[model samples]
Target: MKKIGIFLCLIFLWSNINASAITYPKITSQGAVLMDINNGKILFQKNGHGRYAPASTTKVMTALLALEKCKLDDNVIVGKNPPLEDGSKIFLTKGEVLTVDQLLYALLLHSANDAALALAEHISGSKEEFAHLMNERANQLGCKDTNFLNPNGLYESKHYTSAYDLAQIASNAMKSSKFREIVSTLSFDIAPTNNHPEIRHLHNENKLLYSQKYKYPNADGIKTGYTIKAKHTYIGSATRNGKTLVVVLLSGVKGYYKDA
Candidate 1:
């Protein structure tokens, strides 16, 4: 009888220990998601489908569209009517000529609003037309809550996506070799052009790629966003031991890097 009682107590202790080990991390983000990239299975979620302003992470879709529509070496001439974008720009002047390849690096690395506009105009002729393409592509990707109003993720009430939707977008974008390459590149330098004499040096904004405290050695190829309305948003991907995992956070507080 004493041996049987001891065995039952041991079993109870082991079960509790396992439960504690598997508990989810505490997150302060209003919306968060973790996904297994190989099978497209969601591992964890917190308001993953809740709609909020996506800010510049919207460029993931923009970059995808441009890559599909334009060739790498194709020259995109900046038009006279550049959209007046508010935040983060590569300062492209009217009539500046740059290859689609250079624009892509600027778009993804610097989150350059002007570069996004240039790529959008080069592909679809106007922001309105480019947004149409963005929506069509989002629908094809199985995203139901995403609506892109502009190429750069400027704050617009109509431009919103959920954590789940952004994660799916990142996963899809990562499949493209070019997209993957650009995101993983820590920095790139664009030489002086006829219109702009100074070199355009761009650095990636994803802290998880560079910050010592937040760095994830396996992390590569993703985007980040922030705005007055959107707060701090991020899409992060990491691979370990042949497994790839993607994490998305929206409206996160200061500890987003650790929480992610």
Candidate 2:
């Protein structure tokens, strides 16, 4: 009988050990982490601290800096390269005019590289200057592991951030009511202006919004980033029962779409 009792205790201890080890999934992929907003505790993590190409997720920081440095009502004069070109765009044309807010909408929602340029220009007077500002802002945020070489998460060898650092960025951005409003919006309709079209409908790239059935109940605003080098990266936030969670996934496969 004593032997059996000892065996039982050993089993219990082993089970507890296993439970602790199972806190979160193993980080086999590039980098990923889920954070609880209230306590800032890491609910899950995997290679989160390692640097990797963040793709367009970097735009979150760009948007943050633009929001802080410029007024939404301010107008941005469209420039070349980001408009009427080959790649992702907001249909922005050289010499066209758009409000800072409108350009922001196009930049964040549409992932329009051109929209990013116009907003960059509006904020720093030139793309080169804006890139400098982005780097400075990253440092100010204390994201020692993050670096931004471009406004859009477009491919630039110098642009990379760890999942841990991206979470850091999202944490600060969530504090902004404006950021929340812009990212949570499933769709945005901007009336046509003299310089542009009559109507602009903006849709978020987050697949969670598109499918409308993410396992995460409180899934809210945020952006998605992708490139050949950066696979599919997502910075997503969700809320439930007043508690919020932010997740960052970098260089992962499509299987992670369900929101574990």
Candidate 3:
């Protein structure tokens, strides 16, 4: 009897140890991934490869391409189409002149659709052509399930990316020093443009960077997105003790910031 009791206790302890080793956060998001930036290891994931609308988070790729293709100080003349795009914007008007730097600030920090369109047009002469570039870049990055129909990430039937794919794109973007600096910024001021006289103050939308309630200790940034269909999508990064981590959450019905 004594030997049997000791064996049962040992089995219970081993089970508990195994359970603890496998424990992970309970998240409401339909798709999520936590990746170690240094090694590209997936620490945890739920439906990481499931395709879903990316919403504004698509700007991460847009920002990445802009950094690769243009200089920060390069002048961009806003065209008629960028201003005409609906949804969040810096209210860019046709013929407005702004630097690529200024447009990037608006794109990442303010989630401005117009800014994304402007950058796209500047880079590829049209958003449609820019999307081809986006897909090509995604393929280069080893994104197996991503299709970008627009630079602004506005809803489209085929515009979708998986959590794992987004993490891969974000990881590549984070490698650039300029991209790192831009996404990590908490706020920025875009001086009066040729078309708009008022100074535009852009605030970072990633709560993990600023909100007291939601802020993560070393949170830097990436992007956020939402539409009626896409729900809440976010790509967040943080560095702690010299190790950087990236998290992607998609189709989150509850608060994604808190989940991150």
RMSD of 2: 8.1
What TM-score does model 2 achieve against the real structure?
Answer: 0.85
Best model per lDDT: 3
lDDT of 2 by residue, 108-220 (tens): 78887888877887778877888889888777766778877778888878788988888888888888888888888778876777667678888877756556445333468
State the lDDT at 259 in candidate 1: 63
Candidate 3 regions with alpha-carbon error over 4 angstroms: 1-22
Q: What C-alpha lDDT, on a 0 to 100 scale, does residue 95 get in candidate 3?
A: 95
Cα lDDT listed for each candidate = 0.82, 0.73, 0.87
Q: lDDT tens digits, residues 1-260, model 1?
A: 11111112223332344422344667788988877777897767889999988888889999998888889999999986554667898888898999999999999999999999999999999999999999999999899999999999888899999999998888888888899899989999988877999999999999778887677666786888888899888888776566667888888877677667
| Clashing pairs for predicted structure model 1, backbone only | 55-153
Worst 10 residues of 2 by lDDT: 1-10
Per-residue alpha-carbon lDDT of candidate 3 for residues 31-62, written as tens digits (9 for 90 to 100): 98878778897877889999999999999999
For model 3 the local lDDT of residue 3 reads: 19
